[model samples]
Target: MALLLLFASPLTLAFTLEDLKNQLSQPAVVTGPFIQEKHLRALPQPLQSKGRFVLARDHGLLWLLQTPLRQDYRITAKGIARRDLSGWQTLPSTSAATEQNRLFFAVLQGDSSGLQRDFDLDLTGEPQHWQLRLTPRSLLLKQVFTHIDISGARFVERIELHETQGDRTLLRMPESTSAESLDDAERNDFAE
Candidate 1:
């Protein structure tokens, strides 16, 4: 649930940010499944949820959570929306929220400039598998998130979010492919 960033460049001795960005050179669309696990300090067991997501490069992302509870989230250039028993509700346009959204959109586009603007970026691991670690440098982001780590090969496979409040969320997208054969719902998911 973070930057879907990757690079297409060749991997040499060391994996570079340029390489990651290039690997993620935009595909028309990305559709996949995601598993989210949350560990709360107040609670002993981790909360687990599994779902699917569709990321359309030209539009935005449609993230659906089915287990634990059913929830559908949409992130567009304008803002974030969640579907519940009622309907879509726009999230408040706070600076932190904006930064988070930018992280998602930029990651999908392999645009790290926005990410660099908000976090202390660190690139490590090898090309076959690499990790992008981001530490919040801004006071606003720091208040909410301590750090975010995204790791994968050709696509974003895992996202680890560390919150300053002692809660952590692990989002893993094990499989993903170019959505060249999008169905009616997916084809129009991001239009609105």
Candidate 2:
């Protein structure tokens, strides 16, 4: 039964898309610390920034920066709201920008159906530690982002975004923060 044994061994290690989807557990809101480094085409060194973000499945993302400089971004039904020295202002919501933001949130929030519509996915590694590489399908999306790669050990720990203009951004959110109910900051963002 040596031939039978060989066939059985290979079957045991095969991992499917369903398996990866199950491995990713998306909470209603996942709050975590983040370190984002933007590598620009003209910049000699990558610009680093430290922040915290809240990812909500129904609402949107609340990104806050408390160090180096202060910045806040709240992505809600209205649009992407950014807070500067003046105050909170909503940016224009172009179709491309909206889709790009939704795609990022969908991938992180484990919305399998949303991801499947716009991206062709290739998953590598294993259940414990794995990578999901996405190639954009829509011509509009291709104009913005070339590819997106996400990796984690249980939860999503990192995201690398490659853009069409040759700029890249690497965001690390390895540390798990409180997944409890949305705080006051988060509540106000969605309320608006």
Candidate 3:
């Protein structure tokens, strides 16, 4: 009877969209390293980049790249910004860029409602492990993305972007840790 109770506990916590949002949103901050590979049809090899990222629930994402080149980017509801000698400079936001940024934030923040407005979401599996596929419902997004697949455990683990032009971008976050709040440096970066 005890064994049966132990085994059924996990199953009782069945996964649902709200459950996923709750799991993801419980963490105030998530920090990790990322490996991104962009596969282009015209290129023989995929372009790869390594970076560290900070995702603050109240703030935004800070992507610091250290690879073939070094660059920093901050993505917030306002827009995308790049770091340079002068400091954080806001990039010109195109419609496509705006849509992409919105998508990224929605996925990371578990804003399923935000995502539903633009794409048809198909989610499967349980809480500890699950997959989400986003099929573009909007004409503009359809031209840019074939579909987007995101899977994770406690936090998002990987994102696979399928482009309409036969290009693909795969992003992997092998390790992620959650925190109650951002560090001083991270908080300052978000402020900039």
Candidate 4:
């Protein structure tokens, strides 16, 4: 009976790629307050931090880490930008050296199809709320992240990254909005 019950459990069910594709088809923006909890095996306790995220389609993203320290990251077609109170610095666009960061960009850009080429993707939960588990296929990415779990439905609510070094970072995103339009900013930021 126990064996039968184990085989019948819903947890044993696996999700298909179509399910993930369908979820990404929805058009929406997700802005929110966030908290990042970093846990290192060598540390006594998890280090907590706070932040926010602004996600818009066709435009780009603004990821701001505010708590433990203030930092900002912006990703656009031109490249990735890191900013602080001092100034802003731009990094090369998705290229060979930054494949790991590019993979992250692909995921955030809602291009799961592209991401599928580099990582094994899995999904769980209902339509309203779901969990996306990504396991890196590349040796370099695998060295950094064993797996990445992103939880949320229409909008991402949380992201947990499990690193090969026995460390993890849990990022929680609360529902919110961005007043500034990202498209116009991207255009200006990348003006030639």
Off by over 4 Å in 2: 1-14, 23-25, 84-88
Query: How close is every model to the real structure, measured as TM-score?
Result: 0.82, 0.81, 0.91, 0.73
Clashing pairs in 4: none
lDDT of 1 by residue, 1-192 (tens): 233233423333566677777777657778788998999999999999999998876677889988877888899888998876776788789876876788887765556777788788898877668888889888878898989888887788888999999999998999988766567876555554
Tens digit per residue, CA lDDT, model 2, 106-150: 777655678989889888788778888889898877887899999
User: By summed lDDT, which 10 consecutive residues of candidate 1 come out lowest?
Assistant: 1-10
lDDT by residue for model 3 over 87-189, one digit each (tens)?
A: 9999999987897888898898778888999999998998778999999998988998999999999999999999999999999997999999999989888
User: Which whole-number lDDT from 0 to 100 does residue 184 have in model 2?
Assistant: 88
For candidate 2, list the clashing residue pairs, or say none: none
TM-score of 2: 0.81
- The Cα local distance difference test for each model comes to 0.80, 0.81, 0.92, 0.70
lDDT of 3 at 38: 98
Stretches of candidate 3 exceeding 4 Å from the true structure:
1-13
